[model samples]
Target: MATTASTAAVTSLASVTLEVADLPSARRFYRAFGVDTYVGLRASEAPSTGFRGFTLALTVSRPSIVDGFLGAAVDAGATVLKPAAKSFWGYSGVVQAPDGTIWKIATSEKKDTGPDTREIDEVVLLVGVEDVKATKEFYVGRGLTVAKSFGGKYAEFAAGQSSPVKLALYKRRALAKDLGVPVDGTGSHRVVLGGTAEAFTDPDGFAWQPAA
Candidate 1:
């Protein structure tokens, strides 16, 4: 986060707005993707290439739910960046939207406790930052409280009950690697974060606006 020191405004991440080229197509895609209600959309021709320096992740209770989300995304015209698979952490998959936004569906649980259901545990917005320590300091300097910190590698902020989206930071290259994308990217990030603040732009050029 950057600019004026408005603690309350920048503290909790309230919403996410994705700038897309075609509103109709994007809406249709997200509607099929089962996350349209979680995000706001606007039409913009921002010329972004390669990785966008951020990812919106869906955390679920089991691997089957992860498979369900990823599978739906694929059936809805999303490109598979990484197939659903288990890793050291758990099961997950990566997909690219038709409008070029990247999404991750994952779970820390290895197996399902019961039948698979479309239950999303949480939605996290992870921004790829240049320095996790510095950014952590920046957010902490505001009203944001740190929920978890891992050296200079990553940081997650505690979100209020009113906040629908959680904010987190990770190293740029490492985030790209985790998202299965190249580390090279240029131009607008094409995504805006909405919070209590009227408007602000982060150090990496991620914009923030007031939640509608």
Candidate 2:
């Protein structure tokens, strides 16, 4: 739990809206990964270009599961950016969803000492912002408690031990460098985050749709 004071207005991550060129294609692709994506906006309204400001991460409980997910993604027509491999933190891999959204599947070996659940244990929506400090403060002010922070470089919020999803903020330039991409991205982000708030746009232009 967060030791710092919190309003606790926001409870959990309900969903994420991705702007894709082909809604049906994107839906099919994500559904293949076990996501029940809600297609709210129309195809004509979606931007021609895809958003690249964020990456969705799926954390599992074991290395074998990570490999399984990577294989499934490949079979689902997802382009593999990185094959499943062992890392200092764990075994992981990266794949680009058909709609251009990057999905990283990983499992921390240190945290994988337990039994294999063979399932996605957690979903992390990692937002890349131009100014990490400002973004961190913005979310913190909105009743979110910071679970861990490292100066302005990165921060993670604790939704709860049982919460299926978690939120994280990262430096845009740093994240771009890590992903081997350019720092600047254009077009409507077409991503919507749902919370307790009615409807608002963050400092970085990410939209938040209030949960019904």
Candidate 3:
């Protein structure tokens, strides 16, 4: 199990690969959001269905920025699951990626008291797992350090000072409720996380592929 003192071996989120039926369309949609996404065309399998048990969160510094991002995503053909609105946490919106992945674009109202950059400053890949504690231990055992943790609720891993993206784990049911989705998500995740120590699938079936 990973302790608080575990060293962080993962540095950055190298890439997030999405398996798409129509690769070109998926590319166009994500590229509009400034994500240099790597698309892998499905050779034989049918397209995935329903939620994939995770959501990629793009965090900015202001409320207006959330509207801009959500608008851009809608313009680029993303399906808006939740419209941009001010919530207790901040302003946020949800969109389903063209490749079937869900994304939550948000900004903290408490933190965005200064000038607004209106630009995405950080990316947090939130993986919904059946057990937050056990999953946190799994990553810790693999040499990732816990930056913050709330017992059985959520846990965040330190992705180094210079890393643009960080990794986080959350309880599946809680995450599903927050996203207004079902707890038992069906079909493929359609997402791949690259730049990890080993290639393994988490309890909820999110794949962490090795860095190329």
Candidate 4:
């Protein structure tokens, strides 16, 4: 995506993953925002990759690890969809969380390369919501710069302006229609960056900056 002229060069971000209850919900959510989708998992049963030039893993079943964490998270206000357990791959597993609209928790797959190392690229998400004006004001009030108001229907903002994070907004229904979906937001979803601190809300849902 082409960034604003004043914005500095942003480091590339890798793929963004959503742990959803149903694949259909994911399709509706992203389709609304005009995000390109592709078949992720390979014929060999590996994770999905290559969407819009980024490697994407649609869903990963890691029961062994998820089960232990689900117990702790539920006690802290998380709505559990499925309890974690061992998966087919034999690793710790989990694949359910429906109520927590914001799921910024990091998965086990990503590694922390530290601030000095350049391992991950940046991520920019296009959010679809019910209201455009309200969404724009909400994010701007939270310290995000409105880089450009795309004809008053969509807006793009730097994730942190300096940190390699980015966020984009759009009307949910319109966005869904553009992406070939009727509507969206039927399941859990989140956009996470490896290392940045930012948060904001669009018309339909909330978005967090770099993962904590």
Candidate 5:
């Protein structure tokens, strides 16, 4: 079974969507500012929306849109990831920030009520530690409360107010076994947990802790 994170217990995600004109140029600009980009597809619902004039549509439009959407955010200095790119799917590219906000730039492809309903349900945490209790204590110290407990095997932490990220703790070995892969806790891998919060593991051992 796949482990899950509890967003309801954690902070809630603040989200927005924007339409963009260009993908590659926007991506390049962000890169110059030192923001990493993650290439993604245009929403299948785009074509139905009758949107044109751009190869992709960012959830948050780049250039003026981003500046306006982020407002004080840019002034506060947010890290730029990827600028943008044209995806293989014919739609343009988009990127996300450390925040759950998604920046899309491209033409709408198709229209639908929403994407597939089978999206990830929760973010699962694979903790590498000799003692589960100690790790649990570490997060609890981080102001997260225990929402559900699975013996000593796993625990899902409740998010605090305004926190959109959900936290889960699992024995590293157990998680690997469940995924049908060799357990290597020493290295790092991106764990894209499900639910409203978008989570990932970046390079370095540092976890991409998402804000709720």
Candidate 6:
């Protein structure tokens, strides 16, 4: 949601393909979120449950804009997982989209000084994996560089030479807790990431197909 708006133009994520049951409904929901672009939609009824092992983040510029995007999601039939609130890091809110993707709208800026704008600074796709260091190594072997990291707690990869949507890794339980969801998931991740050097599955079974 939030336009799939991404400033995460640094590794892969050439295309964020979401496999949804209802294309028309999904399209409308995303459109109402003010996003007419990004994220490919395919028809699928894959049985996925619980947390889905990942979350999409819309990083905006201010708290007000964060509120705007979060509100848009609520209006679009998304369930609020966490209400918008200021925190030590910044301000943010979490919502599970109608299609079951957990999205976080946030900003490093804790306060609003001017009128809100629908500008997303970064669209981060955080994968909740079982192991951060190992997965980080897996991605590095696949030609991604580390953008930022903190021991084994978390790690982010540089955006591909020509792509949007930065990729990051975090402990699965930690991510689920952060998103206010349970720490168990089964079946397809319901997502096929584009823009990989080659098609392969990760250590955690997340699929990566070549970007077309």
How high is each candidate's TM-score?
0.94, 0.82, 0.83, 0.39, 0.35, 0.92
Number of the top lDDT candidate: 1
Off by over 4 Å in 6: 1-11
- On lDDT, the stronger of 1 and 3 is 1
Candidate 2 lDDT over residue span 1-212, tens digit each: 22235444565556566666787876677677665443232253644353368878888888877877777778888887777878788888888877677778888873445554447887888889988888887777776789889998999887744445678999877776655556677767656777875566778888777754
lDDT of all predictions, in order shown? 0.87, 0.72, 0.73, 0.39, 0.36, 0.83
Worst 10 residues of 1 by lDDT: 1-10
Poorly placed runs, candidate 1 (over 4 Å): 1-9
lDDT of 1 by residue, 1-212 (tens): 44355355466887889999999999999998889888899999989898999999999999989988998899989999999998999989999999888999999988778766988889999999998998888777656789999999999999877776799999999999998899899998989988776676667778877888
lDDT of 2: 0.72
Rank order by TM-score, top first? 1, 6, 3, 2, 4, 5
Ranking by lDDT: 1, 6, 3, 2, 4, 5
Q: Tell me how many clashing residue pairs each candidate has.
A: 1, 0, 0, 22, 41, 5
| Model 3 lDDT at residue 184 | 69
Candidate scoring better on lDDT of 2 and 3: 3
Q: Of the candidates numbered 4 and 6, which has the greater lDDT value?
A: 6
Model 5 off-target regions past 4 Å?
Answer: 1-121, 125-129, 161-164, 185-212
RMSD of each: 1.7, 4.8, 4.1, 15.9, 16.2, 6.3
Candidate 3, residues 129-189, lDDT tens digits: the string is 8899998887776667899999999999887554456789988788877877777656777
Candidate number achieving the greatest TM-score relative to the actual structure: 1
Candidate 4 regions off by >4 Å?
Answer: 1-17, 20-123, 161-165, 190-203, 207-210
Q: Mind giving the per-residue lDDT tens digits that candidate 6 earns over 154-197?
A: 99887765566788999999999999999988988999888645
Whichever of 3 and 5 has more lDDT, that candidate is: 3
